[model samples]
Target: MRTGQQPSGHGFGSPGAAPRATNQNTVLGRAMGKVLAYIALTKPRVIELLLVATIPAMLMADRGNVDLWLVLSTLFGGWMGAASANSLNCVVDADIDKVMKRTAKRPLAREAVPTRNALVFGLALGLASFAWLWWRANLLAGVLVVITIAFYVLIYTMVLKRRTWQNVVWGGAAGCMPVLVGWAAVTGSLSWEPFVLFLIIFFWTPPHTWALAMRYKEDYKAAGVPMLPVIATEEHVTKQILFYSWAMVVTSLILVPAAGLVYAIVALLAGAWFLLLAHQLYRGVRGGAEVKPLKLFLQSNNYLSVLFVGLAIDSVLGLQTISEMFS
Candidate 1:
């Protein structure tokens, strides 16, 4: 309507207004970014690996006749427990995370979340995890969940991580607690079988973590963390990895008496494959050949995933039926 105005279509009131769209987009993007940052604080991949080991433990404990609702509830509590520990670990290592290239993008490291807020969030999840498991699973399961969170937050993150090269070796004990939690959730008791499952992961951690550390040696060195690869010769570190790899394979086999034939055969084959990969990495490093340590690292993930899947399949087949095949 103005003398020189041909159209008012581009004005603020118009549907096509650029400023309004941009402002909305900016607000939405920031909100989604914050949500993702909070999720990242929980270290989702590690939690996924924890669950892979957990469900199988439960399945075996209950002879594949587990109540689905119980399984779901136990999984939720276990996830919360793991997430709480990881979030708190992030808080404790925020300063070190900023120094490590591998961990620099984490929430506290990048200041996406306030340290106090992250700490509170972690504590809240821990309490919620305990309450949920106690109500839905059992007291023993809840107690185990809390113990793991405490160990991971106080012992591993605070005490061992920066102080020693054996950090992952021993710190990983906290990660193994989920198997026991899963077993207790189903049976309302702990047993040698679940303890054996716990040791498989306990031995598995060092090789898995150290392999990744080999690739990020500089990151740990710069962060002043004493990861084995950062402080030791490749020869020494590779030997250590092999030591743990052997322990992992042997511990996996130790489950055969409880799990029976199908799991035994799968564990034997999978353990062999895992050991092969582990040896290749060591031998390559030993002989001055180019090696991809992360190759072993990635396969280690696959190996554990497969091993647990085999356990689930064995449970489904019924341990007695599977054992009958060999008789």
Candidate 2:
């Protein structure tokens, strides 16, 4: 029942007997607890997808000869930047999160992290991320990340989330920036390639997020967040999902000309599979079948994972195809 203590009284045994050991363990535990609370603010699972999108773009930017040091540094900066934005969001939305099942256990929502402390932590992380990226990568990469944090925290979280049903659609621009950041980190400039990747993610976000909103529609309603599923009928939401799914698929194939036959083939196959799943979700919702939005939500994860992984693989192995097309 004691905070950070073993049930059998591991750190609590006769305080004066093993004072040194007890003090050390207690300090270590508290330090770790603080670290974890901060990490939770960043929403690690969301950052994983961002990194997944980021790394492949770096590889493709460098044609598979990406600098490992650059990748590691960019990832670190990206994590800090993302953590900063998510933390600020939690701080601002603490009240809303407290009422929602999905976000109620967040550090700020649960009052585990003080509002003032969380605000400082988020701001510090944002500043550090910019400095780290600028020092380790390129100025463009650093600036792009700053823009990402601004869009997510100021534009999306503060301005749009509670105000519009189209929040996720517009707000997803922040999430799509990782590819730009990663590409700029390597190439020090923007190109059509990274833009295509950005479009792919932009189109993909609606279905990805709306499916989740559907699963937690009531929670969003309770929180007063105007997510699509909360404001629109199930059929309308699904139709929008299908629309974005197809748009995402189409944008994904634009890389074919640049990425060559291997990437082209993988994109086609993956896009087809993703579209099929979207259609299935639409049909299920339309027919009033006992379908769970989580079904589509889970599939969206796999769809993205497969597509991003395929991109990485093609970047390394698609040289022959690239050479053949260009030769």
Candidate 3:
């Protein structure tokens, strides 16, 4: 065999050895990076907040013994729908997201995931959510879920997000739908109590999100997004925040009689704390002080979580004294 010729290496040191090992490793790394990027597109933090609105509604509807199956189903469906909406938002805002530091690393903006792939993923999740909700929960709940998804994906993200300063004001209604969905899953119909909870979240969204927007005003301005702080003067934004903060407090307190003394006490304390923070932000904005709105933003999130948790607890406790008042 040609004098037992040494096998010729194809750009490698050994015969039959795999070539381009470095390139192969790079390709593997890139694939793994893309997978992680796709996960990030789901917006886990927003999903968590959405769950916050959902769980309390379920507990309140059940009045104590929440159906484990229903809870699980609602959670799965809500998460799927929320993730789908977030992905759609990313696709829609990819261009502007590239200009914002907070959103610059998003998968679509970073080109880690193809736009068509993201769109497909969102649609798949949304369809799965609808099917799950319809089969496991009431049709009303499923319908509400669909509406919530459409409101966020179409009305808020596509139509309003970049078009006006009041985007969050009106878009907030979309975020409040989880409460209605959860309540409908139990009752299979709409009622006043869940609507009250919806209103609480509707009013709460502004101050909670605006504080964050205030902190990121520069990024939003650079991206040409007309977020409240970007479009309105700081003083005006602060006033708006204060107004919504007061409204949230009032709405939350209304649930006291409709819910219970425990809920009332919790709402009172939480609402006071929320108002204090809002007042501080108002002062900071008025004085043109460089106060960190991030503090208020984070605290607002905690405040809402605690308030809702308290409501769930009160509902489970079932204070007859408080229930009779509504009767």
Clashes of 2: 0
Prediction 2 TM-score vs. true: 0.91
Misplaced by over 4 Å in model 3 are: 1-31, 321-327
lDDT, candidate 1, at 256:
82
The true-versus-predicted C-alpha distance at residue 36 of model 1, in Å, is 0.9
Tens digits of per-residue lDDT, candidate 3, 160-258, equal: 888998899998898899999899988899888899999998998898888899889999999888899998887888899999989989988777766
Q: Weakest 10 consecutive residues, lDDT, candidate 3?
A: 10-19
Compare candidates 1 and 2 on TM-score and give the better one: 1
Q: What TM-score does candidate 3 get on C-alpha atoms? A: 0.90
Give the alpha carbon lDDT tens digit for every residue of 165-228 in model 2.
9899999999999999999999899999999999998998899999999999999999999999
**Relative to the unseen true structure, what is the C-alpha lDDT of residue 129 in candidate 3, on a scale of 0 to 100?**
83
Instruction: Assess the local accuracy of residue 157 in candidate 3 as a C-alpha lDDT between 0 and 100.
Output: 87
Predicted structure with the largest TM-score when compared to the true one: 1
TM-score-best of 1 and 3: 1
Task: Write down the worst ten-residue block by lDDT for model 1.
Answer: 318-327
lDDT (Cα, tens digit) per residue for candidate 1, span 1-327 = 879866667765676687778999999999999999999999999898777988999999988575789989999999999999999999999999999888989999999999999999999999999999999999999999999999988999999999998889889999899899999999999989999999999999999999999999999999999999988899889899889999999999888877767788889999999989988888998999999999989999999999999998888767574445566
Q: How many clashing pairs per prediction, in order?
A: 0, 0, 0
**Per-model C-alpha lDDT, please?**
0.91, 0.88, 0.86
